[model samples]
Target: MRHYVAGGTEHGGGIGRLIGYILTAQPQSAHDQLVTDTRGARWSKLRSPPLLWAAMAVMVKDRLLAPDRVHHLHIAGRGSTARKVILGGLARGLGCTHVLHLHDFDYASDFLRRPPWQRRAIRALFRGADRVIVLGERDRSTASDLLGVPARSISVLHNAVPDPRQSGNATLDPPAPDAPARIVFLGQLGPRKGVPELLNALSHPAMASLNWTAVVAGDGPVDHYRAEAAQLGLSDRVTLPGWLDRAQTRALSESSDILALPSHAEGMAMAVLEGLAHGLAVVTTRVGAHEEILHDEETCRFVPVGDVEALARALADLVAHPETRAQLAMAGRDQYRNALSIEAYIGKLDAMHRSVSRGALRGASAQRGTV
Candidate 1:
């Protein structure tokens, strides 16, 4: 069966790179049938609306030419209005089975705020899919309530990363108490990632006693965040390295003692998964599917969102106690091996694809009988 994976192409964004990884891992038998339809602006810039529409037109035409051969369409995106429209059109026009893979938590909240007619349109888009995939059970419930689709129709699939053990650089040594703890934050630097709050936490008097150095990785408004760090009196404690390539990122992860991401929203962060895979002690907010995978104070430390004091306390505690960090790191690595590895995720995805294809065929047969 032919399968088409459609999503963004930007390297910085998680969805696009994830699609690439999935495509690369396809079984040899399915490789010939696998096609990728990348949308959105390359290099993380916005594309004009007409260009996006034209790209969709081309993708639709390609699928229509081999409608019967294409058994499954996996549409991965953040569920914007345009994305919904494109997905709905492809499902109807190609007469193929499709799965809507959600990558952001804001979609449901945004749907709730839309007008009645627009809400109906959004619901229709979800209703037309053979299956809807979310990052967690929380998102599955939200999708059912917001899109009016049955809970049974949604599947919870967490984001995963390649096992760091395979890289042969997974850190096994416990952090040395005499050295400053290394904290690393990977992803865009902005309010959505809780950057301002992180700065505040670092500036708090509680953290003043702790010996820690933070490395802010990835791109987006770097100068602004750097200035904020300086303004918060954290210039000496923080380092902004801008964006790093894959190898650089891996090296940084391997060397770091703690992985910090106080995000306000997420579907499931790849950085968090990578941190777990590398056996690093993670300090993050309880957003996305994190709570499902990470046990607070066991596998990782969880702090309330935007709470400077709580975040500062969490950081300080981890810094002061190397034994606690080691325990959490080992638990995190075990969690990665048991649940969040790429191989495990691919096994689930393969099963979902087969189910979706079978259902699509049955639906087509019923439509013909009705005629």
Candidate 2:
């Protein structure tokens, strides 16, 4: 089947990479890049005009429904209203199947909340889609309530991790003398990620009691987070290595004793999955989709968001008891192999594609492609 993995270049992370991998693995499937400007003036505004997007939509459809070819169409993670409708319109025009996979909670709703036209555009996209894919169960429930899509139309698929064949060793090993029980925070360095709260938690006496040094990975609003750390007097203990590439990030995860993510909002943290795969104890907040992969005191530990005291205490507990840390790490290893494996993800996606294709075919045969 020919899959068009459409997405913006801006929020390209594990999800984008996973999509690329799936398309690349299929010999017949050719991945197409629909590049669009994402640097909006406002934090939540359109980067380009609607006409340009409509033109791009024509281009996407032209490439997908090319003459003398058998192509099964699909678009991943609708970014903007124009882009979303453009793809859906193309699907309807070509009478092809389309999958509306969601990465964030609400893409079109953020700007299109009060506007009736925008809301209609979003609903049109939902109505045109054959299947809507979500990451976690909570996200699935929210999608149903917000989009008014039937429960059966939406599928809950957990983000999966590709196993690193080459474990860290001689060339790329964990931090030497992994003493002082170092911890790492991997992901975007933003306010919603709770970077400030983590710094505050590190300032407490309990965190200091553990002889811990932190290596913070990833980048976003660097100056702000650095200033916050300095203000809390955590500059000495915390190491801001900025953003590292995939290999470097994995090495840091392997070296650390614990991975902490005090995020205030998250779809599902890929860093948490990587830390678990690396056999490092994880300590994240309840805001994330951890309920799908983790159990309190089993595969990982949990704390309330922005609670410095609770975070400090959780870190102290992990640092103080080596046996507990080891047990959690072991459980994390098991969990990664069981639920978050790449094989499991492939199976889920394959099933979704088949189901959606069949549904679209049936819908198209009846009247039009309004699946």
- Give the top-scoring candidate (TM-score): 1
Model 2, 126-201: lDDT tens per residue? 7667777777887676667766778888888877766653332512344444468878999888777888778888
- Model 2: CA > 4 A from native: 1-11, 20-82, 105-112, 165-178, 363-371
- Model 1 lDDT per residue over 218-298, tens place: 889899999989988889999998988777888899888889899999878888988998889999999978899999978
The predictions' CA RMSDs to the true structure, in order, are 3.1, 4.6
lDDT of 1 at 56: 58
Candidate 1, run of 10 with poorest lDDT = 3-12
Candidates in order have lDDT scores of 0.75, 0.68
What C-alpha root-mean-square deviation, in Å, does candidate 1 show against the real structure?
Answer: 3.1
TM-score: model 2 vs. ground truth: 0.81
TM-score of each: 0.88, 0.81
TM-score of 1: 0.88
Query: Which lDDT value does model 1 have at 41?
Result: 43
Candidate 1 achieves a global lDDT of 0.75
